[model samples]
Target: MTRGLVEDEKKEEETEKKAKKAAPAKPRKKATKKPAPKKRPDLEAHPTPEKEEKAPPKTEKSAETPPKIEKKPEEKPLEYKNDIVEVSVYHKPGCRIEMQIKASQDMVKEAHKKAIRTVSKQVNFPGFRKGKAPPEMILKNHPRDVDKSWQQVIADVAFKEAQSLAKVSLLD
Candidate 1:
């Protein structure tokens, strides 16, 4: 019985080795070329020649001349400050808070300024003194920081309002 068991084990090991050898190795995938992009119609070839000709020309200006920067009109703040934040709370097995914040341009601008000031204090930018640079310039240097700050401010405001508006404890 012992001899028969030893022979069976040896046969199983041989079979496994044979099976591995019989199986073919997977071939690597060849890189395929992407299709060329479609050509767009030229502006000069468009049918609206009269509209293009009517536009004013600054063709004589040198390459070094800075482009005219147009200041966007500032949006007026909401008449009712209370209406700025609308919070919705769902009370079920688990509490869910949903908030829609309507921020005027002025509010966003203020948040950006605050974020810029905070970032500038921590980080040193070239050519400008620390925390003394313009808000717009500082914002350009640390866009992610400004965005995060604004989002944090908005979320804090929303959560505070939601808690009061819902009147139900969210943690419970």
Candidate 2:
């Protein structure tokens, strides 16, 4: 009986080993490649049409509007006057002269107007286009800034005239 039992156990072990060997292996999964990034549009290669490149029409003026009255170019307040600014120089030692500069009311006003025009070009005001802000509004809102710019304009003109009269190079 013991020999018979031992023979049955040996037969069961042999069958288990054969079943495992007969079974097929599972298939391995392949790695997937990532999609490539898209390229940007080439503007130089394909330029925009001329019609599409045009700027939007200004709202202030239209073809149907009445012709504006032309004023004399000299009437503009920004016209610079070289003769209006009076300069008095006191002689000193070492090629250094003490200069006294005085600008008339008209000249000062012109300088202020010119400064406004310059400042207006750089800034944008509400309901106004670039370089088109009213002088009154610019003066009212930025008085100190406009005054400083006007002073700088006066100094520049004075220095240039002084340099020419002195017959010497102003820059060291």
Candidate 3:
């Protein structure tokens, strides 16, 4: 699960950078190919007297082979074909989402354990000692299963923060 996303993120970033035109340097334009340089007139081979100087120097062949220039096709604008959803920010009282979201999801889980203990001390569990389970252990047992549980608590805190702001009319 973790491995897959790491690789995916690289590709995603590359596409995003290209789409946003955030590349460090723009792509260089490609060059066209040109015909190979011709043999210099002075460097042309002088044949020995034995063979009567090879057929008048093959001049017709070089003349027939006109110099050619080749250029690569221009690239199109960088297009991000991937789907990107839009998002909006709504100001609400007692919303602590910004501050709350700052903490890692794990921190929320820790807070939940703390809350659970706080609640459990005043209440009782069937077989366990009162508040015996450490927040860490309770969390370990639940493990990654409570993935969104942290977010819910954070959202709740954010709502409370937002509401607090609203109470003071800050959001107004």
Candidate 4:
């Protein structure tokens, strides 16, 4: 019984091996070639037709209606005087002689003399009594009085003239 069973196992293994070897193999397919693409034309190679720039259509009503105009009120000219202030000098030492006078050189000199005479009569100097000293003596002996009187008189005249100038500036 054992020998017959071993002989049956050997027959089963041989039948499996024969079945595997008896099966037919599949055939391989040949590769196909692809078609080439056609050439494309360049746009720059052929010139395009020049197109006319079409403007937007305008209405007749818009042409008849003119743009609103603005009229500004005329400005008044800045009131100015031709009175040229040719200030040859702005500031100087108290002892220095500097002025702005419209009169002639001789007239201005004469005016200075008159001013000195007038001021000397008004100021009280030390000694030699009051309002009695000559212009020369007052200028030499009482130099302080001479300087003060001269400044005061000139200032008074200048102040009167400046009043008009100040008014013009304020009004303008």
**Against the true structure, whose TM-score is highest?**
2
lDDT for position 145 in model 3 = 35
TM-score of candidate 3 to 2 decimals: 0.27
Compute the lDDT of residue 128 as modeled in candidate 3: 74
* Candidate 2 TM-score, true structure as reference: 0.46
Using lDDT as the yardstick, the better of models 1 and 3 is: 1
Q: Write the per-residue lDDT of candidate 1 for residues 1-172, one digit (tens) a residue.
A: 9999999999999999999999998999999999997677663465754554565655767456888899866444222234444443332333443434455565556666676677778778788888887787767777888788777766665556545654546563
| lDDT per residue (tens digit) for residues 1-172 in model 2 | 9999999999999999998888887878889898896776863477656664677786666656977999645321122234665556655559766666667677677777789988888778989999898988888888888888988987786667655654436645
Q: Candidate 2: where is the Cα deviation over 4 Å?
A: 1-82, 166-168
Clashing residue pairs, backbone N/CA/C < 3 A, model 1: none
- Alpha-carbon TM-score of each model against the true structure: 0.40, 0.46, 0.27, 0.29
Q: Order candidates by lDDT, high to low.
A: 2, 1, 4, 3
TM-score of 4: 0.29
TM-score-sorted candidate list, best first: 2, 1, 4, 3
Give the alpha carbon lDDT tens digit for every residue of 11-72 in model 3: 99989978788646776889989989998989989876675555556677777998788966
Q: Lowest-scoring 10 consecutive residues by lDDT in candidate 1?
A: 75-84
User: What CA RMSD would you report for each candidate?
Assistant: 21.0, 25.8, 37.2, 33.3
Rate residue 55 of model 3 by lDDT: 59
